[model samples]
Target: MGAVNLYVTEQYLLLKTVDTLQQKYGFRTLFISDARDEFLLEKYDRRINHVICIRRKTFDWSNQLKQDIDSYLRKFYQQPQLFRGKETRFSIVYVSNLKPVDSWEHLSKTMRLKGRKNATVTTYFVDEYEGLEELGKLTNTIDKNDNWKMEALPPISEQERQMVYLEQKIVAIHQHNQRKFEEIFQFGKTKWTFVLIIINLIVFFLMETQGSSTNSLHLIDWGAKYNYAISEGEIWRFLTSMFLHIGIFHLMMNMIALYFLGEITEKIYGSKRFLFIYFLAGFTGGIASYATNDAVAAGASGAIFGLFGALLFFGLHYKELFFQTMGRSLLIIIGINIVFGLAVPQIDNGAHIGGLIGGFIASQIIHLPKKTEGTKQVVAIIGLITLMSAMFLYGSQQTSASENPQTMAAIAQEYVESERYAELIDWSTDRIDQGIEHEFVYFYRAVAYLETDRLDAAEDDLFRSIEINEDFAEAHYNLSVISERENEIGMALEHVRKAIELQPANEQFKQYEKELSQKSTSG
Candidate 1:
């Protein structure tokens, strides 16, 4: 039995299923896959481009396969005495995935093996020519399993096609059509990138010694961004959290990205400014995370996003160099990652956004040592102060969520750490009772409500928070997410765009806007 020219990404599962069926039905199975499934067909083809060449030859190649099968069957049938020495008495040949064509008589009633009593041949003509009824006139309409004749797998649905298309596009992203690692690293300057990767790897090792970094406790102890811990005054985490990661996979991905992005960033901005931007982005990301999520989050993603922002800044100043060098590659990488973050769950979007904005602003402000060095320094200092002030304002509002009293806030922080969400809610409520109408308070309560699956309550709280702080970036983003869950896609886009406007450098918000806008239009 054979399946010819089937399109699929991973064939292992399908092949396994076929193998199981073969053993149960007592038949040999063969699979003919398209290029996408080349990995599975490697052993069978042996030589690269050989099978593809045969496939591309189309009419001639298929005719040859038909001739070879006929010759084998004729020899077996005519010389039964010679074949009787073999184990199996009955044989069935199955051919599938014949492209739709009117002229081809793939199989016919007159086709026969004279003298052999135990030979069966079946053709599985897939239903690829549907939608267009004109093709129906061309097809003889081979009945499925008529007179012990045919069996074919169902065609892939439209949804599956879209998914496959999306996957293929994602997989096709290349640094200038699959550039060598050495080429990227050796292109301009890679010293700082190399150094950053080394530092991250070192941090990951220490985290493993403490406990597997994926463990929440271990991550927090290793300075992974544990929100409640930070709120309780572990401020140093703002700096250290960027170096920690939740798992080996997370660490490796972040490090590889740094190795790619860091070198160019350092070379463009110079090492000192690069260091400054990275740390500022990290700090701002931590602040954003604290203001948004109540859960544990960590990684160098925010810092990585910061690098993207810096690249954009450089691109603005040196458009030709940016476009000529790695501009297209960077765009692809950023788009894929942002889309992935938006499509998937359990990502720290606020931090990514914060880092991006921080980096962009830093790039605009910080300048290379030149004749106008003092003027650049003064402007950068001012810009940094303004950004810091804005962050501090948000942090102050966050304090209201913890109850306004320092001791009460500390206790609320402890409650959250212990997973005492009910207590957290009560503390938030108490502040409200005492006339607290801050967005931060409402946002925190919404978080608790959402955690407990009180969707209506969460929605109400989120809206109230937004009403209080119209410029609240996290509120808008959270509401957009809630809207998406409710299938209010249009509303989701509106709020997400608002979030992006409020925190224009936020990569996650931009991603959300992109995804939602697309969905809304398609829908």
Candidate 2:
């Protein structure tokens, strides 16, 4: 004897009905299904057991089906003698090929006559389209047995499906709202966002209070100052300028943009990652401003550009979620901003570009939490770190160097006279030190050293410059000067020629070539 067994087909309604009955009656029942339809049955009732797969035979052969069913039943029902010495009975309730009620009764009687007194069998002859009707008939059959009591099953209606879908949608909305709130309120615990906001606001207020100060700080005015400032160590000016705006309108626009973009980004990638992206982007903008612009640049636009870059990268990376639905709108917004940046002459395009790049790189790092341990992730992290380190070191040195009056005067004078040698000499002894390998810095330093009669120092700085940037034509040309001064005629001529090869139309290098040739001939 075995526990009561209930068999069902792949019909969803019938399976649901059976599940309801099982729960209500507290019956220790085993469910059996054909292997081909096992997944469908389990989707409705996961507790089903004794699944038997019927092979798709060309002919309807009872022997093979019986063998498979018998094997499945025996495997599940077989038990050995235990301390209780209890016997188990097997009763099968099957829902399949329907016929008259009298025909099912005859089948039940025949099974009883086969000496299986403890086994009770019930069958429902149900039409494929008449599943609901069949479920009712099956319930009636179970009720007729003295040992069985039928329990009511929940009714399935069109309204129920709609209610379930609505519930899921409500849950999704709640989750999204919760995430958004977390992003907006991130500053409460960390204080970073609050601090950044305070600093930016203060800078904005200072700029507004200082009348006519904004007018005097155009890109051209700032650009000239930056060239000299960098050599003397006024690097903070590069970053500080970005935080200052001309007027209330300027500050309002930038702050609003930051708020909206930061909120969106933070929601997508939590507060910690968002803050990292913001700061990195701002830093990159400062670097770009230092590298390209001479003017006093002040604004949060660089960070804004970074925000756009982050959004673009995230949309592309998670295309299925972010881009598939709203990608076009995002692209339009990005395009408009880029166009605006290009159109406005006052805008620090270099800072915007740098910030964008920084944001993109930062997004990759920030979004890669899923890639815990992989080659790609490792490379990305390393590459980002290296880039940021270089930018930081370069910006710090330039800013610090710019504040030195002697260095600023020397660089300005060297540039005005097109005296590459003078510039190099002034820069090498004063600015080029340990950990400074920028080609521009080295090239100018090398020239200054050569002009000031320090051939050995000139050669060292020239080679160091070339090492940092192999494509630097000025370094090569200066190397030619070092060779000429040292009386290495062939080496001087060769390096001068290489400089010409790198930049053919450069009048300075051409002039250097002629001088080197003359010096070589004289020697």
Candidate 3:
């Protein structure tokens, strides 16, 4: 009877400690048995990704305790789906009422030899055991006598009744956790995700109708991100380019990613918040791309990555729930995509990373639906504004044409279209001096020199352009013209033959080749 009473007191204390650990210390229920004799609880410090495990059981021998600990460690390693960390730092807390017959020194040595480098096991015995005082301090069970409750308890089997109560408490905790998880996603409806998808599809089809979406000139006309245009104060391209795409395949991929990511983000953040996050992410992503790249870029990749950032923010608030639901898979997918982007030279990873970080910052600015952190949100908003401003200022200051040939080429093309030969000559010369020794740059300058009647300079530049790019049909054709002017029919025929071979479908090359052949035959 006295043993039964002690068991009852210990069970009650165990239940109270479990409740306190969950409610106050933020521990999550990991495992619970129907018999309620044993259970496992875990707590994670989300900030550091550290984990603590608490196990409850009765062990009659030190070896039994050691065996259980070893088994649990095996299970932990085997079930990678249960957690995501490269090297998890695990601290296992073992709680029991019955003391082992032997000292734990041998078991401790065994654990040290076999356990993971960062794993450790600590034992605490309750109810008339040596570790009771230390356990009391940890669980807030000191100086509190729950033994009095056993006397008022029903005259039923004490252990069975306590087990039943413990099971009920565990069930209630699970129910509470489920409710909280459900509540977080219930605040918003998914509207903007679908709407954005429609908008992107519409824009893609419209862009195709205007001309080919793959055409750089057409893309620029339809508001793709062109660095030279942006540098010329067309800042609105940053926002508009997100709605554009480089090709049908690029559009399709982005829309697919957006459909899935947008739905979840919209449902979590609501339409207004989703819009804020999307645009902010896209804008920052564009700026980041602008700062690092001079390519004519377009897509919703930045905004899609921003959605990734938004979910990351959600995880920060509800770490345990996030891991339980989509954390592992999300992290794996993000890792794979990032690695793929790095390996592929054409991928705009700058935009991806920028949007990810921007989306996180944007989420911080708006916070959750009903939650408000006044100072934190304000700081986030200011910080984002300052960061974008700095990036924009830095990008604008990078004026060396040698550094961005695509932008320089675009500028040269603009001059060519407007018949500004003098300006083209001066601009190309400046670029050439700055080490911008591209085939197109030399060809454009040669054309300008030819227009100004500088035949020798034009011929020299044409030869240099062909030397840089052997497949430069335009340079070859122009060199043939210089040879023809000097009455060198054989050299002119040779140059025109190469031009015609390079561009078989060009009527101009064919016509020039025919003229050069006739001149050679007449000579």
Score candidate 1 by lDDT: 0.59
Write model 3 residue lDDT over 1-523, tens digit each, in one string.
4766656656665665566566666677766666554556665453323344455567778888878777877777775544544334444555555668778645533133144554444444544355455444443321143221212334437556766676587769877876776678766788888888888889989988877787766687889887766877899999999999888889888988898888878878888999999999999999988877778888999989999999999999877777766788888888988999899978988888889989999999998777889999999999999989887877776644435666566666767776779988987887677676789889989988887889899999998998899999989899989888888888888898898899989999898888878877877
Tens digit per residue, CA lDDT, model 2, 214-276: 453232133322544545566555455656665677777887777777766775666777778
For model 1, what is the error of residue 61's alpha carbon versus the real structure, in angstroms, after optimal superposition?
33
Per-prediction TM-score to the true structure, in the order listed? 0.42, 0.40, 0.64
In candidate 1 the C-alpha lDDT for residue 521 amounts to 81
Candidate that would win on TM-score: 3
Better of 2 and 3 by TM-score: 3
Q: In candidate 1, what are the lDDT values of residues 391-478, reduced to their tens digit?
A: 7557646754553333343444555566778977986897788676667777877877777878788889999988887898988898
Worst 10 residues of 1 by lDDT: 45-54
TM-score of 1: 0.42
Clashing pairs in 1: 353-506
Candidate 3, superposed: residue stretches over 4 Å from native: 1-27, 30-80, 85-168, 399-403, 406-476, 482-518
**Superior by TM-score: candidate 1 or candidate 3:** 3
The candidate maximizing lDDT is 3
TM-score winner between candidates 1 and 2: 1
